[model samples]
Target: MKIAFVGKGGSGKTTLSSLFIRHLAASRVPVMAVDADINQHLGVALGLDEAEAAALPAMGAHLPLIKNYLRGDNPRIASAETMIKTTPPGEGSRLLHVTGDNPVYDACARPVLLEGETVRLMATGPFTESDLGVACYHSKVGAVELCLNHLVDGREEYVVVDMTAGSDSFASGMFTRFDMTFLVAEPTRKGVAVYRQYKEYARDFGVPLRVVGNKVQNPDDLAFLRAEVGEDLLVAVGHSDWVRAMEKGRTTRFASLEAPNREALTLLHAAADASYEQRDWERYTRQMVHFHLKNAESWANAKTGADLAAQVDPAFVLAEGAAAPQPA
Candidate 1:
């Protein structure tokens, strides 16, 4: 299962991600949870102390992996074995491999647990807000390309992508590789608005979108969210004390998630399973709007077409009987 959790800032995505991992691990199910958020809160949410996490840099670093891409085709991978942590505060594995034109293939080697079964963690690149031009663009795109390449050729059964926050370009580009998407939102107005933005952005990439609302307190709020997000596309999750427990060095599943908590997780599983199936689009259609098509036909009609210059300022178009505008 390749699952992705995405939403704007402060929407409880990290919290939900923690719950999902706890649930899967409790069942002894193998899973790889990738933390894509810039804040890097999944570890804290899982009760891995800040000092411990900081000491676990090798948990997600890959230097030799980067060298392979620079070496071109047939660069031998000395060992494809990803390092796994069996100890507490680091019950996960981190692996690294490279066979492409990406220096950041080294970055995809996320740490996971032996009990995490197939769980992996790839931290988002530490790019800043100003890195939107060619440099960062190609960098993240290359990383995304490498991620897909590795996944298509790997053995993992599931990939839980914790996406970077907001509707940034890197996040959008990363989503292009996902088959389905989960957008986490809150009952707040900004959450609703960001959720809608995420839906529209997902549509632009032709991927189906679902919603998960966290910190929801009232039934009416859930109703309102469902009404806006469509009943089939949304799930409501109440706040859980498990989040605080994890912060205190207890990487345990919240008991609250068992009965009522199970409901949301169950629904989430259905959504995640649907995504896990990996259905590829076989065909596509591209057509102009009917009004635009009609307008085009009218403009091409020699018998009834108005002077083309009428569509614009005649003086500007003619420019005193001048030539065409040159490319800038």
Candidate 2:
């Protein structure tokens, strides 16, 4: 399952994401945690000390290498510059499966030792001073989308991403890459407002947008969420002293998790068994190419649709046995 946790800033999305990954790892399940946020704090949430987390490499720093590795035996992708995010994966392209050998995974994955077991954690990139004026985070997250486009998960394996806050996800196609997206919403008006925005946008893409209500202190808080999101509200989490204590540096161990949060995670795990819909590669590639071409016209000299189509792998076809039509 490719799960993304997104919400308004301060809505506890990262905490929930880290907790879910820990839960899965503790259960002896194979899990990969991705810190896709520009803030990049999922490492601390996952119990990594600052020094340890800082030691891990940023995936975006190696994008050129990763793209080259994923190109594999594909003759069309002779170099990193030729393979854009919309480049469809052919038999020659690297295949990143849950438990098997994949050059893409090898290039980016870093071991995060936790609870006597090692979980693989990969980060997209950190916000840098050099990007203060020009770089969009969308470009950084595009690396994650490229990785997911090649990933193949098994029944018991999971990929959880801690996404950037709020509607910033709309800056790119990364939001559509998830099998399930947990919108961690608070009971405030702004929090529920973000939920409405995501629900409306996701409807067109068939993305499963579920709400996980955070910091519910009473019946009224839960009721407020129920009123706003209706059936989309999957679970309501109560205030957790344990988490609060950890936040204050009393301890680093996650000993007593809130019950409601645990129940929600259990449900999330069960849902993963049947939640994923196998995407049509050719269709997805075409949509991504269209998105890129639209951006290219405004940002670069690549003015024609044909210019974008040339970046795609011709041999990568749809699951329904058809190739994406090249633009004229």
Candidate 3:
């Protein structure tokens, strides 16, 4: 399944995404986890060392061959089709792999800069400055197109995109491209407030919304939110020491069951799929209130009998009180 993850920064959404990838990979699925967020921390969170995490640069590093072709350069050497790396499943884990380009070096080298090519092209090893900021980062639409092509054309059944934080235009664009969208929110009022705001806006656009409240300490807090946010589409995964899972280079179900470093991803997988089957609570949203109020208004108007029942009360009014009962 191609699932997308989105939420505010520091929401542990990326970490959660990592675990799902790991979980799928452990089951022997050829998983390709894309760090759509420019920060590119998935490798670190997955316990890959520098040498191990090094392939990401290639995935985002290359300037598209179309740019080279447009520039009238040789097409044969400019394409990154073969060099982009992918991670493979291993013994109860996953093995790492990359194809041709090394973005860490490619990004640093000056290039015939495409108007948007910003990873700062270079031809070298490490980067002292990694996230030049996504604005400064460049993605050749060709590369993204290639990735999508593979997903549709080949054997990879899963492609998980860990998106950037917030509700920017790019986030909206990314949201549109996916088959399923998962919004990660926290239990705090601020989190719920932001979540609702996005939901209302997205609903206007007809975005099918599913919510996951991460790092929850009290399930009751979810109850409170249900009163306001409509709990039918909401699910909660309790606050575990998620960072501790990252710090220890392991998972508390962060990515796999073998090591669950206080991460709630395991519950996330199940909760995400089972929300419809498991949750059954009355809605407390303003929409429901308004619906019932409108219903009551209709009921009151019906009782008035301005149109129906010939201006009659069930037992009293008879079309302007015509012919009252005489003494029997």
What TM-score would each prediction reach against the true structure? 0.64, 0.87, 0.54
Best by lDDT: 2
Tens digits of lDDT, candidate 1, 1-328: 4567787888878878767776666556556566666567776665556765444333123434533332232212222221011100001112223222223433454445534443445554444556645353323433333343223312224556667776763332356545556788877788888877777766754666788887778998888788777764567888665555555666453554447677788677667667644544221101111212233345423433432222211121111112221111
TM-score-better candidate, 1 vs 3: 1
Which digits, one per residue and each the tens of the lDDT, describe model 3 over residues 255-288? 3343433244555455444433331212211222
Give the whole-model CA lDDT for all candidates, comma-separated: 0.50, 0.75, 0.44
**Residue 70 local lDDT, model 1:** 24
In each prediction, how many residue pairs overlap at the backbone (N, C-alpha, C within less than 3 A)? Answer: 13, 0, 20
* Alpha-carbon runs more than 4 Å astray in model 3: 66-146, 149-156, 169-172, 232-234, 241-243, 250-328
